[model samples]
Target: MISRIAETGHAVGTAVGYRNLSKKGQRTVKAGLLLSPVLLWLVLYKYLALGYNVYLSFSEMSYTGEFSFVGLANWQQLANDPVFFQSLFNTVVLFATIPVSIAIALGIAILLNQQFPGNNAFRSLFFLPYITMMVAIAVIWQYMFKTDGGVINYFLLQLGVIESNISWFGDSTWALVAIFAIQVWKTVGFYIVILLAGLQTIPEQVYQVAKIDGATRLQRFLYLTLPLLKSTIGVCMLVGIVISFRLFDLILVLTNGGPGNGTEILLTWIYKQAFLHGNFGYAAALSVVMIALAVVVALIGRNLQRSSHL
Candidate 1:
């Protein structure tokens, strides 16, 4: 009887071990199946494309139909390039444009979040700019910023603010400011939608309670609304910073980095280096720098969120 009992115990252990192993294998298979598509896309696009770009960044490839390996030489040349510095300054100069847009968006979002009549209509109207073609916006904005007879200047003159039309898009000095104005106008609505969503997630009861306690609108906004919207604000700011750094199409359409590389940001600078100057490798290095800056901006935004909580 003792021998039979021992044999039964051994059989149970073996079966349990086999079952566990089978379950482990099944889980492994499932995980692989789930990740296969993502891995495939990574291999096909991100990994391979990134690898090629890195390789190209180390060489000299110009539109003049010449290609040569130059090691870190391109990076070295780019380091000493004046236009590169100008581009960096231009990129930084344009950074404020997006934040202003976000602020405007926040204001608009607050208005839309109110239980006023036609709230939906207001929200939709604000979002229209986001869907508008970048090229069209750029074109129309350029005409409005024209040196003479521009609508903005026309109104300013009529209002007696200025005796003459200011060269909005003409002078190199004021050109960046003009670009900022246009960028803000085109994107404020987009930010408003984002802020509106964030505002909606906040509970109505919180505001109601504040109101019940005699909190003024300004006080509630400062103490409760701003704190509650921290994460959303961070996300919007981070995205805005990243997008601002990468602004190319609109800049290209409006100023083409005009008046002498005054408005040329990183991407246009990259285009000039890679295509016009035939220095793909240097361009790649610049691209990496821009990417690193974006990552830094994201990190800063997260840090701000943490501090706001504290």
Candidate 2:
């Protein structure tokens, strides 16, 4: 009888262990199933494309879609291309609006943070541009910037700001500026939204303490708000750099990199080279340069932020 009881107990133990092992195997399979799609997408779409682009940059891609490795010939050509330097300079100059946009956004955020009538309405209005269609915005601005019978030029003429209607997109001096202004107009709202959210995260108690110490509003803002908002500002600045540096659509719609390439940016130049000029290898090299610029901008922003914090 004791032998029989021991045999039954061993059988129960073995069955329980097998059941647990089966459950573990099922969980492992489930996890793999969930992650497989995302891993496959990243590998094929992102990593594979990036590798192919690098390969193309080193090869001569012909109009017939044939390619052969030319051992840095594309890179050498890119180095000597005058348009590349002009586009790089324009790319750098476009970044000038980032600080201006952030500053304006921060100001608006501060104003919106105050207790006032129609505060939510104001916020929604400011953020409307960000949610609106980019193409629609561009079209509306294009009309407004028309050389004749345009609302903007009409107002300028009315105010004696200019002698006559000026072609905002035709002239080299104003073409880049017009694009810059449109970029700021479209993007300022996004930064404002980010900053407003950050501002709300600050504890009211901090302000209360400062008030108790009899600090003036400007003094409190300078001493506390700016310092505390550094992280948020840093994030906005980095993102703004990336967005403004890769500016293409606005220039495409407004100027098409025209007025003698006055408003040409890196991406637009790359588009022109790849599609119009049928120089895919050169475009790939330009893309590599763009990636390098982005990395350098990110690094420089980080270092500047660290130094400021220290």
Candidate 3:
């Protein structure tokens, strides 16, 4: 009887343990069901594709599209390419607009923050360009900057600024300036909206207290508004940097990186390499370089933001 009782107790303990494990298993299965789709998506679309691209960067493909390892040949070619260097230079020039854009946007944001009749309408008007189609904008700007019978040239000629129609897109020296004008025009609205949101987040009571203290407009802006908006400004700066690097459509549609490759940039060059020249491996290498540069810019921006806190 004692042996039989001991055996029964062991059996009960096993049943209890199995019941506990069953409950735990059910919970785990529910969690897996919830997370599996997201995991599958990332693994299939994002992680696997990134890995494949990296592999392609180091390998060359035959006409049959069979990839074979080419070691550092692509990188060596990229390093020696003169057009690559010119593209890099143009990218830097485009990036120079970031601070300028931010400054102008800050001013616009401040103006929009004030109360006025039809304020919302004016705000939308300023922000319209950012949401407009780039292809359409590029085509419009091409006509606006045309060499002969262009509206811009007509105005300049009327003002006695130049003797003849200036080839804005066809001249190497002026091509980038035209690009800068369009870029600033299209992007300023976005920064303004972001900054205006930031401005609205600042407490009205803080500004009221400044006004009560007899602070002048400039002093209040310098001491209160600018200091409080530092984080927002930093974010805008980072966004601007990324946009400058990703500037393909505007360059492609506007100049096609023309005027003797005057406006060539990283993305434009990568597109040309991958699609036009069938240099997939080289283009992949360029893409990696572009990603690295963007990462470096992000790190630098983060460091600056952190240091500002100190």
Candidate 4:
């Protein structure tokens, strides 16, 4: 009788364990089923597309959909292409806006962090440009930077900043400057908002303690604020780098890489090669280069962020 009872108890315990395991397996399957659609979409649209693009970089495709494996011909062409180097240089130059925008945004954010009348209104006003359509902003800026009767030129003339009207978009020298100015104006507001949030994360008691220690405002900002805000600044730098690289639409609407491709960056040049010039293989190679550069920059940024924390 004792042996029978023990056997019965063992059987019931095994059954309970099996039931629990079966339920766990079922839940796992359900979760996978729920996530399968999104996973499939990403596989098809992102990873597969990326792999195909890499393949295309090694192959040539004509305008009439004629495809042929060209091996490294496109890359060799890219190595000898002056326009590719020029676009690379131009893209590097666009990074100049990152530091300038960060400085301006940080300054504004600091000022706005203090208690002041109409502070929220000022923030909203500054952030207005960020919410506006990029193409619309580009169009408005194009008109403002017009050679004749533009608001900017008129103001410059009135203030004796320039002796004559300047062709902002038409001139190679000033076209890039115009692009930089518009980019900074459009992005600074967003940076300001981001920096403001970073600033708020810092406890007010820290500032009070600094003041008690006889620290001047500038000293406190330099020694206290900047050190604590390092991570936030790193985030801003990475964001700025990404934004600078994705400047195709703004450049397209503003200069169309005009003034004899003077303002041409990687994306604009890629668009021209693939769509206008029908050199899809070469364009794909350029894209690969751009992606590699972006990855390198992002990795560097990540390392820097990690080092700051250390």
Question: lDDT of all the models against the reference?
Answer: 0.80, 0.84, 0.86, 0.88
Tens digit of per-residue lDDT, candidate 1, span 12-47: 997786577777786886799899999999998987
Residue pairs with clashing backbones, model 3? none
Q: Best-fitting candidate, measured by TM-score?
A: 4
* RMSD to truth, every model: 6.9, 6.7, 6.1, 6.4
- Per-residue lDDT of candidate 3, residues 86-202 (tens digit): 988888788877878889999989999999998999889988998898888889999999998899999999999999899998787799999998899888999998899889989
Candidate 1 local lDDT, residue 200: 85
TM-score of predicted structure 4: 0.85
lDDT of 4 by residue, 89-130 (tens): 888788778878989999999999999999999999999988
**What tens digits encode model 2's per-residue C-alpha lDDT throughout 83-185?**
8888888887788788889889999999999999999999989989877776678789999999999999999999999998898888877887887888889
Error of 2 at 166 (Å): 2.8
In model 1, what lDDT does residue 32 have? 92
TM-score of 2: 0.82
Write down the TM-score for model 3: 0.83
Which regions of candidate 3 fall more than 4 Å away from where they truly are? Answer: 1-36, 301-310
Clashing pairs in 2: none
Please state the error at residue 281 of candidate 2 in Å: 0.5
Model 1 spans > 4 angstroms off? 1-31, 62-67, 212-214, 304-310
